[model samples]
Target: MSWIYLDNNATTKMASEVLDAMLPFLQESYGNASSVQHRIGREANQAVALAREQIAQKLHVKESEIFFNSGATEGINTVLRGIAHAYARKGKHIITCQTEHKAVLSTCAQLERTGVEITYLPVNKTGEIALQMLRDSIRPDTILVCIMAANNESGIIHPISAIAEICQEKDVLFFCDATQLVGKQEIDLQRIPIDILTFSAHKFHGPTGVGVLYVRRKRKPIQIPPLISGGQQENGFRGGTLNVAPIVGCGKALIMTNLHPEIEQYRDELEKQIKLQIPEIMIHGEHAQRLSNTSFIAFRHIKAAEIMTALPHIALSSGSACTSGLLDPSHVLKAMAVSDDDAFASVRFSLSKFTTKAEVEETINDLAKAVSRLRSSSPAWQLFKDGLIS
Candidate 1:
């Protein structure tokens, strides 16, 4: 009765290396980063600096460009609010997609209350926004365009590079929520013209309550008002005391994931096996480039929640963890024009570097049996059996 955990997207198991990195900070090195006089404060500040450097090294950006936040949700809110307040004179218009995380969408809605106009670009059937549509969405007053690098539910990767180019040509600031893609994919900030990028360390093997936001140094400094006004932490962009322990752990986890690159292949094999074993399952966002570790599958004639209950030996999700308990279909699926039936039956399987071939095999076997049982008892199957094919 060994349990398999396949919900990396929801959260990851903290890596041992990360835990080791944080141990000192939690015990012997417990000191406020903002303090100046004490040796403890100096040591804590040094650790924070090193963590910043490590995060910057992975993103290929300068140390000064990275800022730590509570998580991706905060990072997103900071950018949206910062941009709206800072660039209100430039334009009241903002552009994003319907598939964006609730963090981004909700922040945009909040901005709307303050008079900022928002345009949610529609995605194609493949769960990707058209480049031309993004290009057309930009107006003279468009201040920013926020789009996620990889969808949290469907695992679809957006055309960020193209979107960056469109923003660059139009001089519109580009913000990317890379929570699902960072550590799982290569993000060369030097090569890409991204103004702002957000990542949650927990998405990888890092500890929770740690996130990174990369602001392009070369881009013009947008006067983003502070979200939390207090001490001069995070260059005054984000205030209050920094969480040094989790930030250090996040840095260590990121470094470890980067060192071991073969996890991508493991994820690919898992997806291949699941597809082969259950060919009838409709794979959402199949036509687009997606995160290697994620697979969103819909078991037709079977409820996703029921399948989840039946497969207690494995841990997975129906969609985004934040929105899982709700009965509504994933906004990402709905944006891609997925039918209500397919959306309701969908399940998200996100693997990790620690996942093994044996585990994947076991998952496929269990899922196949579960789907078969559910389908056997399905009213849709009975209707089809009675010659009501339509």
Candidate 2:
């Protein structure tokens, strides 16, 4: 009746337990985690340490491997730049996908200015990367391979285990941008053979401005130099006062998580109902294994902005939240070889554990009505019916 939120991949509502866990640190126990002498500081430090262990347990990694940071953006840059800076003598070459979030693409671009030879692999129409393509891309000069565990826009899960195996064989460091899929999907680093991984707590049901960079150091400690240097924090890999509240919240969120098959059913039913009503629509990444709570849809001959405007009560986006302000077609769609007009016509509907069946049903009904109104008024739709633009 009031508002239906479907743009959860951008961020999720923090779980009640997560919020409850954070309150003590925010109010009464507000001592800085880095302070050494005071009891309050020691308590805060203990909480941070517990949170570190919780996160490590969730990922099947060592507590010492976890380094807290602002969010995935910082985590990604730290891994990318840290590898480049520390291992430049080994290789200046890094590999990633073309459809990566700008946090990665932009960082690689900046690295390019400094003589780094970056290789961006292309994905198929399903938004899935081929394993052999990745193998062929590697060379003796390649030091790092960066790929996402799942795509933020399309929700298509990449073959991370295979990618990591390739990296392990080649002795190249692998960095997985698990920002979109880390919590929703189970990732056991102990079995995957990935060297470095990044994720944000806000992507799950935790507060923003807190994230983890899981560096595999159980075999041999990684030698990445800290990006921010001043005080010795995060084992000197990241400096500055630790965020105790969000870290505790993130830890609580992770401990309270599970696989949601009901959410997947809701997403599928949402698509089925929408397609039955609006027959000409396309569902991107439908064939690939994807996140259960995501649906990226495109109504032929309709602009995504128009649909959002028509359904004001339903929250949505045309692409990743990082680039939602931009008016151009989605770069991820374009990279997957989707047409220019179709790319502009797409909208992303991301759900979460809190998303209910009632909300999804309402969204489906509202979306059909909105699409009908737009398709009737559009000159492009008229041209499409006339077979002028195919």
Candidate 3:
């Protein structure tokens, strides 16, 4: 069986070079970074410092701005909850989009229980939030505006810079969940003025459980309380014995992937071929600026689960890994106003720099065969063909 992986948005395989970079740190150089007096600890601290600089360089931010954490979930909590507590005296309201990842949405939910007001901005059919609506949502008491740089499911990019401009004018803190956008898109902290950002290493080709939060040090000077308590690590922001291997792997992965060229060509070709082979399938986020490696599709009357179950060789998903197991369709597609039936019919196929054209062609053939076989047996599909379904 030929196995094809098109689920890079969920996670990616760690590159060989990244693994090589981490091996030494995991074994010979293992030491508590907080212990600067010992040589081993000094070397570990140096490795951690280099990782921070590497991540910061990729984002075009200062080294001090990047804080290593567990992953985007913890980063999201650290920023949202941290800000809610830090700025409670000033305001209690926060604004975010409805289609945000569970990390952001759940954190906001927790804040709401504590009397913090949260406004979830809705999106249009194309999964892009309106800049005007965001401006209107701003209140005098709004403490933070949380939005992602790119959506995990559709890969559609939000107007983050525009959002930043709105927050700046309103004097509210802005935090961007850049988990999907970090390696796929270039983020210039010097130009855009984004106050904070979160990204995970596994989204690219790095080890999991390690991520970075980019916080502007000079201009905005965000000084939220530490999310955890222990001896000073991650510059006193996060307190844990550093996972040196994964952090070093993350740095190596970022540096390697940034130099790699765009994978948009393969993605575009896959969607084109899929459309030609399987008629009446709708692809979402076609008009918006999206990540180069994502293609989200909906077969008119065939459920995505049926197609997924029929094809075992290819690796893909119907939505975000966090919500895929739930009974309902993706909240992201629902937020875009896609019908429940159509939402269930949708699937997200994400590519990586390593995806080959041959694999894409094979996936197209498999999808076409699966869709044809399912539609032949589907009474609902037959009714839709006869104009019985609207």
Best TM-score goes to which candidate?
Answer: 2
Error of 2 at 74 (Å): 0.2
Query: lDDT scores for all predictions?
Result: 0.87, 0.91, 0.90
**lDDT for each residue of candidate 1 in 117-196, tens digit (9 for 90 to 100):** 99999999889888888888899999999999999888999988888988999988899999998888888888888999
Q: How close is candidate 1 to the true structure, as a TM-score?
A: 0.96
Task: Indicate the worst ten consecutive residues by lDDT in candidate 1.
Answer: 258-267
Clashing pairs in 2: none
Tally clashing residue pairs in candidate 1: 0
* Structure candidate 3, residue pairs in collision: none
* Collision count for each candidate, in order: 0, 0, 0
Candidate 3 lDDT, 1-390, residue by residue in tens: 599999999999888999999998889999877788999999989999999888888778889888899899999999999999999998999999999999999889999999999999999999999999999999989989999999999999998889999898988889999999888777788889889899999999999999988888755467688889886787788898999989999998898866344478888888888878888888998889998899999998989999999998899899999988899889999999999998999989999988988898889888899999999999999998899996
lDDT of 1: 0.87
For model 1, the superposed segments whose C-alpha errors exceed 4 Å read 259-266, 387-390
Better of 1 and 2 by TM-score: 2
lDDT of 3 at 15: 89
**TM match of model 2 to true structure:** 0.98
